[model samples]
Target: MSRPESGAPTTTPPPTPPGESPAAPLPAAGPGPGAVAVPPSPCLSKVELRVSCRALLDRDALSKSDPCVMLLMQSRGQWVEVERTEVIKRNLHPVFSKVFTIDYYFEEVQKLRFEVFDINSSSVPCGPREDDFLGAAECTLGQIVSHKKITKPLVLKHGKHAGKSTITIIAEELSGNNNYVELFFSARKLDDKDLFSKSDPFLEIHKLDDDDTFQLVHRSEVIKNNLNPVWAPFTISINSLCSCNYDRLIKDQPGVALWDRGASLGRDVPHADEDLASGPVDGCG
Candidate 1:
């Protein structure tokens, strides 16, 4: 991970109110008690999103979690399931290959939530509602579009569990193309700023914007007590990294008190001609 650039501060947009929903009218109530209500037809300008989960909590009694993700849209303060992924058996880290298409109204804030469930194979004959709750993550379409790609840690409280998970989201506009890049980084002989003679270091990657300001694009986890730290590899879209401009000013910073001190760092930029399996580029400070 790289350190965020020290450029003009970016303000986060206010989040949509908790109880508010889209202006579209809800479907009529079900005729019988305990009947499920149908979802309203989605409106214009749809966008497709890819979702994946990492480090999900296992909820099965005798085996690892058979996780499935549910995509929901907020309507009238209630969540309506718009799409769901197939159950991935016994995997804590699951990449849902299904792409979800939802209405994208630039004028309105579309609140979205992703719920993870541990599916019991036996319950498959019944319905998805019978799956065990695992965890959930929530965000708005505006927030996702603004960032291009967002990775957030999932919380289990929303699903009534006490556990953690992570969700990676990539948004592809209906009319735009998608490009991806993989990156790996490491630092060596970093100055120790802490009293214990070791530094807690991380990385933030920022992309220079049109206004000559840097916007944070990716952040790495903090590595403790190690001058030589190699962060986990991550994949991000080229557009989100620098709007697809190879010459754009890409800034990498170390997240530590001694960042000002000379620390040797390495950066590996992916090449278009090379396979995604290629190794990271090493840099020396």
Candidate 2:
């Protein structure tokens, strides 16, 4: 098992985030879920949101529509704007790279809204006359996280149709712990598991618990058609990784049989052609 490299220069974490300063203190979304706001005394979790649109209305007559998305949250009848996505030019189907992070609590219901717009100029315009409207969607933060992903049709101000436009939202929860570990790893000379293509491989980080059990802490994204894969570096909280115990056993193995490990990094599991072997511990040995 590898320990997080220590004493590396790092920026100090902020004391507490400067949350939105609403005009007036809004009440908690009770009885019903509401806005760029979310849940209570509440169990806490951080959620990362990603948005994509498909078959959107093309507002521009000269070319494909230039589209952007605005995220709003409802707080007990008040709507607060949370974040806005970058405008994608000349494309009807655009997968935005912007990520929205929000606090989640288990006690209360949380609401969310997405407003997609077609930008006509440098400055963003609003209202029906401005005619920049494309489509909008509303749902609860709980719903999106429960489904892990959701797709809903964009609607006009009052549930009116905005053509065939639709939006897809994906949600991922982050570890809530403070201490973290950063890892960078790669592998070479992996076995070829596919007949027509190169192997697709990734890595998994598992923590050995006090009960003599292993729990998965992290998994790298798959890199396809490559035997020599240099996976991207990732940061994981030490609490989730091993309860802040570096000496605790960690499994940083390639996706393969545990016996073969470092030498057999190939494909992921559940596939017909799974990884041929496993990988190394400690580091990129």
Query: TM-scores across all candidates?
Result: 0.45, 0.49
| Tens-digit lDDT string for candidate 2 (1-285) | 854357433344435547844343334333544433442356888877878899999887777677789999998898899888766666788766466888988777888889888775544444223477888899999999999778999998777988888999877677655776677777777787667787766666555545554444555656777877777887766555555555663443222231122222233221112544554633432
After TM-score superposition, the amount by which residue 114's alpha carbon in candidate 1 deviates from its true location, in angstroms, is 0.5
Clashing pairs in 1: 1-203, 2-203, 2-204, 3-204, 3-253, 266-283, 268-281
RMSD of each: 22.6, 20.2
- Candidate of highest lDDT: 2
Off by over 4 Å in 1: 1-44, 128-131, 158-162, 176-285
